[model samples]
Target: MALLNQTQVTPASFILNGIPGLEDMHIWISIPFCSMYVVAVAGNCGLLYLICFEDSLHRSMYYFLAMLSLTDLVMCTSTIPKTLCIFWFQLKEISFKECLVQLFFIHTFTAMESGVLMLMALDRYVAICYPLRYATILTNPVIVKAGLATFLRAVFLIIPLVFLTKRLPYCRGNIIHHTYCDQLSVAKLSCGNIKANIIYGLIAAFLIGGFDILCIAISYTMILRAVINLSSADARQKAFSTCTAHISAIVFSYSPAFFCFFFNRFGSHVIPPSCHIIVANLYLLLPPTMNPIVYGVKTKQIRDCVLRILSGIKNTKSHSV
Candidate 1:
């Protein structure tokens, strides 16, 4: 039987999942993924432009949206291009070091994105529950501090993960089932006893994923309570409507991750690999695409600003003609 030493397993096992196929994969998957990548980038770029150019959008809500767009962009940038190269361009087998870099950035940005979403939920709760306090609570300094702290926390927490993976030996088969270096998949590749890694990964997931989701739920609960006390039905409806898109995005993002972690633990490995990749892509891509559209519809100022920006561009074109 083959044996693994301390240096046998490359860090790349944690970054690139495996070079399973250079040819046999369906073209259909690659094409749609490319389309989604384009849409995600374009949508996020448009949101950034709208926020930067439109002075009226300088408010706390829109500022938070801008940060959300940035996080979504990071999320897409981290996963999509590499995935495309693997699936479409036939560029498989990333270097061990490159894989670790990818793993770090992917987890960091994703955790940060989750943290930002939780903060946004809190922002909404503050806005709806204590309208007067919204400015005080969601000030630039406060938002900046929260963002910085969240980022630092994600970076610091995941630092240990890199070191842990680096120490694992890879004597057994180096094949990872998924496209990317997911925790469980990577752990399965380790030749050493991986009970510790498994426990750590599950704990990290519970702490980061479970904790963030819990915070979001609590924020929404408080918001709901405040909404209930509102005398006007219109007020309650309007408040809830503003949160609908965010709620949808959160549910979409969290549910699949939950399913992947929980269901796969039991005997239900029925979910195919392709489905997992698609859902992961959706979580990163869909939010940026939907946010501007939803917020534009929900907020009158944003709607008018987008329309005016469109009109101005058209007028400029007409004048040039």
Candidate 2:
């Protein structure tokens, strides 16, 4: 339908901006952005690889970590490459179809991250709140089902926007203010009525991502209560300690995201353009880069596995040399 609409009317392409006022500094700015992208990709990939290859790490928590790594990697890939092109190569033009593709993957993966975080919260809740029944409650098949549900939820909610966006008439010039295609950024460019599109986007975002955040908060609250009820101080400490990794991961993931949300919605006049833009980019890059380190430090099992893997590679290199 969007393609049909595009046949008659639509911009041929859209130009993406890196950081509006910092055009001259794009090359320099891209250096740190590029470094973060590389670290995020490498760190997430290594974590995923560790989870897959290590038998001991094959459990519910690792399962959610795997999902998160995949989602974050996709989100990073969707934006950073094109962003690099704009900054370094000065190639800002992106075709309409390609822009939509980028838009779908970016938003879909972002929502997927929220879904996976919810799953992780549930896993922690079950493990802490029902220790004896944890195995029975979240068996391997059940974990697989949870992951599938996460994937379907993310995809189904965002897929409609693809068609809706495709059908909108684009009379506005093709220059997008940001580095990538997004719902609000794209919808604002339409020549026709955009109330429906904006309304639907808000509904989907809140229904899915908002619901996930609410559930996560509830899950943690229960987990905290359970921890406090334990008789021994050591037991309480241990249980709370176990949650630090998830808590850190959640903070790294959501802090920048919510800041970006507010910065976009309410900071138009208050926050400077460069500050908001930097926060927006960090919202996409910070989680994957920090998640692994948080988990490694907070969860001994992951840290041990990572160390073993690194040591094995080092030994191999020494023998070869």
Candidate 3:
């Protein structure tokens, strides 16, 4: 038994069970997943292009938005393509090292996303509450520093996860019961004690989710107070309208994520595994897909830019005809 344990410690690879009871539907499932992946990629890339090129979008708000879009792009890309491969080609094998790599990207980008959202909230808070000093507050250097801080926070926080997972002895058979490599799911496969993994994972999740959510809430609260005090009705309306996209983004990003997290940790026994897995995929895919749409619809600047580009293309086609 001891020799068997020693030999099995290093698994050549782990087989990903795409979705436990939905094996037959994997092909069908890939269709929508593929469609969302395409939309997320195109939309985020469009935002990035517009932000980089459009002189009008060179504001602190758009700068933060560009960061958010970039984060969304990387977060979804890290998981969705491999998920599609698992669903479509039946290519579900992932090496231990590759799994850890995926785990790092997924978690790191998630933390980064949360950080970006917090920054967006802060931007709005400052813009609304301290209109006079908004320019001075979020200067180019400050925005750059904030972005760098978020990136570093994500990197430092997630690098340990890789090491913690690496040190584990995977004596159990290498079958991950999900589409992609989830930290908890992979940690659970280890024969060695995983209390450290669980504790650290919970801590990391709280540090990212709890801290960000709290800050966002506080920022919005102050923004709300400031808006209410404005003398003109139009001013109040404008203030609230500016936040519509950010609020939608917050809902799209955090709601499913927190649900999936708690469900995976606490309600796994009661909830269906397939449901949990589906929500987990959504937690990754939905935000990237919806965020761009939300911003495009609600943000006048981005919407106008998109419209201008479309008009240009239309005119070019008409001239060609």
Candidate 4:
């Protein structure tokens, strides 16, 4: 339909602004993003290999961890390559279809991450609040089903946005600032009335994104109550400690996202362009980078697995020596 619309009316070419202090920024952005891309990929890939290869890690928590890693990797891949192109190579021109595809994957993976976090919360809730049923309640099949549901639902939910984007006429601006197909940024460029798209986007934000956070909060509420009632100091510490990583992940994932909403909706237009660039990259990059750190810090098993994997490689090379 967007293609049909394009045929009907000639869309104007959008003029793009090179980053201020372009020559200096060219090298500066390159160094950090290059390093971040390496870490994001390496950390996520290492987690993926550990989860896939290790037999002991084949449980509900690791299942969710693997999913989180995969989602974060996708999230990083979608934006970082194009971002590098823009910053280092000055490759800023992206076709309309390419832009929409980027938007879909970015949102799809993010929504799936939200769903996975919700599932993780449920897993914790069941384990802590209903200990007797933990094993049966979170069976292998059940975990797979939860992950599948999260992935499919996220992908399908974004279908409407694709159609909505197809309907809108984009004659105004082709150049998307801040390095990626930010939904709001794209919507702002639409030539036709985008009140419907904006409202729908907000509804999804609050209902799907915001609602997941609420569910997580409620689950933790029950988990905390259960933990407090436990008689053993060791038991309470154990339960609370188990949740620390998940709690940190939840806060980091949701805060910047919702804060972006606040800034976009209420903040002044006078807000610096750097604010947009910084916040956008932070939200995209932080989740994947911090995900490994959270699990590594909070979960001893993952940390051990990471060390074992590294040591095994070292031993292989030592033998070669």
Candidate 5:
């Protein structure tokens, strides 16, 4: 048995379940998933193209938005492609190293998104609370630096995850109960001591998540305080309008995130594994699908640019016809 166990050794591939206990509805569920992924990719690409070319949108806010869109794009591309494959093609076997890479990017980009949201919150707070110094405080160079710094932070924070996960010996079954490779999901498959992995994972998650939530809360609270003090109703309304898109974005991105984090970690006792898996997929997939819709529609500048681009394309088609 020892020799058999030694031969089994470290796994090369893992089996991923696509919405367990709901296999009957996999085809039905895939439709919406495919639609959301399509819209998110198109919308984010359009947003990035617009921001790159449009001189008017070359400001700090839009730049951060571009970062957000890019992060969202990476976020979805990491999981959804494989997820669709599982649902549509039944290709559920993922190589172990590839799984670690996926796990790294997913968690890393998630942290990147969180960091970008914090920067966005800071941008809005400054724009609203202190208009004059906004330009001075968040210059173009500064914005670029912030973006790079966020990327670096995500990379540094997630590098440890790769090592920690790889250190574990997976003598147990190589089956993960979720579609995508997550740190927890993959770590749970190891047969050796995983207490350190679990502890480090929780600490990292809360540090990034809790810290950002606190900072965003502070920034928004201050923003609300400032908005409330404005004398004219129109000015106040206009100021508040700028924040609504961001507020919606924050809600769209984080609500499900925290839910899945807590429920997946804690609710295992009460909830069915299938339900937990579904919610995990929902939170992982929701932000990328919803962010572009929220920003592209709610923000006037991006919306107008998108509309103008569409109209130009239409006019060109007409002329060619």
Candidate 6:
């Protein structure tokens, strides 16, 4: 459908440009991407299994960690397979409906991850600042409700993006200059006025990312104050140590995300398109790939449980042989 007549016609499919200048290197590139995807899937799955089946791992902190792992799993899964197909098989075309579906999952899970991080911060805050009430404050029922609320908030904020993108008439060419379909990326393909799309995208990002960051900051601030006042050096060290993994997770998850978000909108003139695409992919891939390793190394309980599980398996195998 041509835009020559000023009559709007939606393209049935959009062509994803896989790493604009690095097309020749895509096969080589997929090596690391595929590796990361495999690690992310396996590590997150292990975390979920441990948290679900190990009775000792069922605290509020681990519950929030499970949610973060689940979110990372889905977020990476939703994009990487198709991305690999695009890179290795030259499968660049995604149906319009499929694009919208991908956009929904990508954005929704991104928001949900932020929410989960905020919840984790809150968990640490209560655990450190109000240790006496930690159990009562973050009971299983409360955790479930918090999880539900986080999910609902993400859904409520992201559904409009689907509609907004769907309503845009794709009179422009159907080629998206990236691996996967994102709201702003897809919106850029439309010849229609996209002020609303841009505005709403910024607002949603601000509300989800900004609000969550603020809450996490406040939680940590209070946690720091409480830790400082603790008389015992050991107690203070323990409290800060418990939060290290969560803090690392937050930094790994948000830093790339915010960089890509602002860079795409403002840094295009200064940054290469390839760099943007690479960062965008990393924004989804890095956190999932790193979170498990970070937590497994930082948290003694998780590390000990994993060691026990591995030893039990080893013993079973030796006996069977």
Q: What TM-score does each of the candidates earn? A: 0.89, 0.94, 0.97, 0.91, 0.95, 0.97
- TM for candidate 5 is 0.95
Candidate 6 local lDDT, 123-213, one digit each (tens): 9999999899999999999999999999999999999988999999887798899999988889888888999998998999899999999
Please count the clashing residue pairs in each candidate, in the order shown: 0, 0, 0, 0, 0, 0
Task: Please write out the lDDT profile of model 1 over residues 1-321, one tens digit for every residue.
Answer: 123343365443433442233336535677776786787788778878888888888877777788888887887787778777777665666666666676677777778878888888988888898898888878888888888887887888777786677677775665555566655566667778877777777777777777888999899999999999988999889888878867866775676566566645763467566566556556666665566566667678777887898899999999999
lDDT of 2: 0.86
Q: Which pairs clash in the backbone of model 4?
A: none
Query: For model 5, what is the alpha-carbon lDDT of residue 116?
Result: 91
Candidate 4 residue lDDT tens string, 48-118? 88889999899888888899999999998998887788777777777667777888998888898898899
lDDT of 5 by residue, 106-202 (tens): 9999999999999999999999999999999999999999999989988988889889998888877888888899888887878788888888888
Predictions ranked by TM-score, top down?
Answer: 3, 6, 5, 2, 4, 1
In candidate 4, which residue ranges exceed 4 Å CA deviation? 1-24, 268-270, 317-321
Candidate 6's C-alpha runs over 4 A off are: 1-8
* Local accuracy of candidate 2 as per-residue lDDT tens digits, 39-114: 8988889888888989999988898899899888998889888889999999999999899999999888888898
Model 1 ranges off by over 4 Å: 1-7, 11-25
In candidate 6 the C-alpha lDDT for residue 117 amounts to 97
Residue 148, candidate 6: how far off, in angstroms?
Answer: 0.6
State the displacement of the C-alpha of residue 224, model 2, in Å, after optimal TM-score superposition: 0.7
- Residue 276 C-alpha lDDT in model 4: 57
User: Highest lDDT: which candidate?
Assistant: 6
